[model samples]
Target: MDVTSFWLAGRPATGDETFSVTNPYDGRVVGEVAVPTEAQVEEAVAAADAVRAQAAALPVHVRAEALAHVSRRLAERSEEIARLITAENGKPLLWARAEVNRAVSVFRFAAEEARRWSPTTQRLDTDPGGAGRLAYVSRVPKGPVLGIAPFNFPLNLTAHKVAPAIAVGAPIVVKPAPATPLSALVLGEILAETDLPAGMVSVLPVPNDRAPALVDDPRLPVVSFTGSVPVGWAIRERAPRKHVTLELGGNAAAVVLADADLDWAATRIGLFSNYQAGQSCIAVQRVYVDRGVYEAFVPKLVEAVGSLVTGDPWDGATQVGPLVSTDAAERVESWVNEAVAAGAKVLTGGTRDGAVYAPTVLADVPADAKVLREEVFGPVLVVQPVDGVDEAFAQVNDSSFGLQAGVFTRSLDVAFRAHRELNVGGVIIGDVPSYRADQMPYGGVKDSGVGREGLHSAMSDYTEEKVMVLTGIDL
Candidate 1:
């Protein structure tokens, strides 16, 4: 197997201890990555702090040009990065390619944001209380940012953290998930070629136990983490007083109204629930169908889901691949079995082989069941029937997560109702909650997360606003 080293302070850092990265399909070792020690994590933080000022002082145009370079370089190597993502994260090649494209878009968006960023000017004399003063609110870098990325969407999610920090001129230390560090390390390699300062970025693949060193360190003033809810909240509790943005877990739902087209809704529901093995935060885990159309929609959804091909991720024909590991597949199986024991019927697909779990569709699952209540993070979807749009909306809202929800309705009133009543960061009309534009503000509410994460939104999170007032100045 090939060996990869962590990218630290514009150079590769190798250590004696290493962890193996295996392909979830067939259990073959793809590569090995060196694990950083806690001391190394501290070193990375200090290194980032050393050049924080240089990164913060970089001119906006210079930062924009550098991000543009990174974007161009990424586009050139898209295929290579996509293959790496597939090998490590167990996502199909097609989806991996899409993720690469999204990562490139993220950098481009950040580049554009960097070039166009400007302070908001306010007239301080609105009420004649400050007659001759003008005030302006400017966003400044929040110093060293500790960015922790998850395994799923390894490239784009890391970009969501790293690209914005660079756009806003904040030095960052990224600790990618150990299972999928190669993609982020490859990104770090591309970024190392840019004109960013020496200590501006570091991609360290450290053990989970040692993550606290990076999280609770005093030198890093900002913490942006994308992962499970428990881990994210724990990090927030342990970290010092700093700007923290947590993009945590979600058990997202999609409501199918009686007025909706069942075929269209079923097609979208199947596509998203099985996409990338249903590892997305906003993947349609729970679907609430209006009882009038429940019988028709469920069968169509089962047929649509049954048609998906599950096999080797490298195969172009494969639509769904293995879960991240055999253990994850086992967990999904247990959850399905638990739901089954609790009186839920499997409409189709409740089987597993090695790391591969067939796309599952469950009907009549109780609200209190584990599969219905928790973030499965697998290719299992629960479809529940509701009386009407009101009941469907209520069922969708009955979750600890409020990341995003989808409502399939033709009526503007229903759409507006979902928009107003559904407790989520975003409500999608006529599509699955899985839909997300790379430039849109995306995050969660409640246990889902604490902050938003698009190019502009993340730039805002990585920066702090300061108001400057000139006294006795002509307006």
Candidate 2:
């Protein structure tokens, strides 16, 4: 496949300086693509600005149809996009395919949300004779949104921002992570074929250095970014005037209560925590098992972590793949090593290859260690023993990041306590921390993120509510 350049404003554009997308398994060049310069970023922004009104004016059903078409196209070409994703991102092929399926779900959910946002009405009564007044609510576009998606879950994360923006008649300029832009480019091409107006949406691959020009544009009414905490903070500082939906970093916690079924929780937690090499915002960063089951859970987890097949991402049987780049793998290795040096116990799998780290399990990690505090963004899970549910909640809420958390408990009281005391955005019960439905209200609190990105919730984030009051005695 030729990854040389991409289509911008309905035209193919290439740059002089090219960057190679490497296969992380063996460090081979999968393809080479050109990174857009600041000038090209400006072109994309201008293109989106030019067609904002036309795109926004389309009827709700029309918009829905166009988005549904993209969904269908994505489903039909799922394997191809999955291959591209695995090639560029180094995720297992099965995981990439699953992500493509999730992407389709995002479009479907957004399409449904678009059809539901049509004008609505209500009657209001106030004071004397004011009872004759009428009031109603209507939706208005927030104008062109600048979507900056990260490498992790490239398609779904981008869709979480763009799908909702487009659903609410807002145009978008998407900036995909340079390391994993091919799937987004393919979707951009599919979108261009829809009834969407010219320049309504533009997908441009830009290096990290060029992000400021994309985020700081005044024409962009809202800036939706999904990335690390530092970058999200910087974007907020730079674009203070622009509305932002930042899906930032997270150090998610999973509490395995005493009443929980160790067998069931262990299997599902292993699947979720280790999936995608644990390169997700909701990945299980901290596991707080009760003292009763801590001994039993530790061995079960080590065995489960040992079972993951790590190798070439293209292979269907592969469970874990390399990190997006060698640098990412090395960073994970360093964090794990630092934690071990600081007295953390490595129960199993703390080795690393070029962009590939073994599914590592650490016990008794110090709270101040990078492995416990910062997001590892690799397949590494830290296990700690908690005195009880209260201590579990305390330990979970003791972090600056409050994105999401999970609890495995059969007791309703314990579950409710986790829900109430946990400082994260969503607290899952009987499931791992890595669960996210496309239609649910999804986002973070604190430094994790701001705003939300599900179906209806995201639509609301991309739109403004206007109330129109009419008098019965207007004449």
Candidate 3:
């Protein structure tokens, strides 16, 4: 089989060492990708640093057109890209297709945003001393960006980093997760089709160990990372003087109130908890149910989880697939076993075979169990009954992760209260926490990490404001 080309300075290149990407379900080799050597990495960085000024000075129309071209090409090749995603990452075709569609929208949003992104004028005539003075403020790139993306939702998350950087006219170098580099390599292919500067984009499948040096490099002043909590925080600490944005881990919860549509809540929670093999940062991990409907909701949730088909990712009927590796499955198995030994009752599933762990539901989980307190990045859900709205809200807030939460209530007042009290970044009323719009400010607080994603929000993160004062201007 042919080795996939890594993008260096918007062109295809190869290195001395290469690694194979395999399917998690069958362990079949999906493809091989070249790992960039030290010299190659330096060259990519040098190219981006050398072109920073030109990249930032690019006309808005140029950036918009390049982004639009990528968007159109993504739509045209969506199916092939989805297949590649499944082959390398073990994501089901249904979810993989959704990921590609989201990427399609991200680039389009970036294009639209680039077209109308203009400077704002503030008149400084409010005070007599500042009369006839005008201040024009515009956002400019901090410098070339180092975007480190995770394996789950590889294409869309990479798009989240790349699209925003392009929209703001910032040169970007993307370091895709080693497990699923194919989807991102294909994105570089689409980017190469554009008329943008060669140094504007580079996708390097650099090994995880080598990425820290890239993060610490002085040439790249902006770093945007989306991955595990420990790694994201470490990158931020390593580059304290740089502009860093971290979108880290989450143990998202869904609150079921007495008045919520119990059937709707059960269905959404069951699916989202196991979606993408529960690899997403906001994949439902915790469930706090009102005691009034706790018993009723438990059965419905179990049935919903049991109904999902899990197998080969390529199968259109398969909804849940394997974790990225058998090691991940083993870790989840250990966590589940620990919870069970601590007196947690398995309501539905508590089994694993090879790389795939069954969609699991646990009731009466102890407060101190790792599955409940930490981000369980697997297909496991822990349910605990709360007495009332106060307890429910409190349970949701009793965690280090404040990424997002779902409150399934029809009452406007309760929804408002959830929004006000839930310590998460975004509260979803009548839905699951996995819901995210590509154009909205999406991020978390506390241990979940800082900074926001989404086209417009990320553009702001990648750039800083530069104000020009016009003295003695006639107002």
lDDT of each: 0.91, 0.85, 0.94
TM-scores for all candidates?
Answer: 0.98, 0.96, 0.99
Judged by whole-model lDDT over C-alpha atoms, candidate 1 comes out at: 0.91
Model 1 stretches astray by more than 4 angstroms: none
* lDDT of candidate 1 over 55-151, digit per residue (tens): 8889998899888888898999999999999999999998999999999999999999998888998887887788998888999998899999999
Each model's total of backbone clashes: 0, 0, 0
Model 2 lowest lDDT segment of ten: 1-10
Clashes of 1: 0
- Tens-place lDDT per residue, model 3, 1-475, is 8988899999999999999999999999989899988999999999999999999999999999999999999999999999999999999999999999999999999999999899999999999999989999999999999999999989999999999999998999999999999999999999999988988899999999999899989999999999999998999889999988999999999999999998999999999999999998899999999999998998999999999999888899999999999999999999999999999999888999999999999988999999999988999999889998999999999999999999999899999999999998999999999999999999999988899998999999999999999999999
1-475: candidate 2 lDDT, tens digit per residue: 5656665765557866778777777777887876766677678778878878887788888889988998999999999989988988889999999999999999998898888787786666646656777777888878899889999888888888878877988888888888888778888888878887777787888788877877767889898889989899899988888888889988888899899999887777776777888899998878999999999998898888888898888889999999988888999999999999999999889999788899988987887999998888889989989899779899898888999999999988888878788888898999987899989998889999899989898888888888988888432
Best by lDDT: 3
**Candidates 1 and 3, the one with greater TM-score:** 3
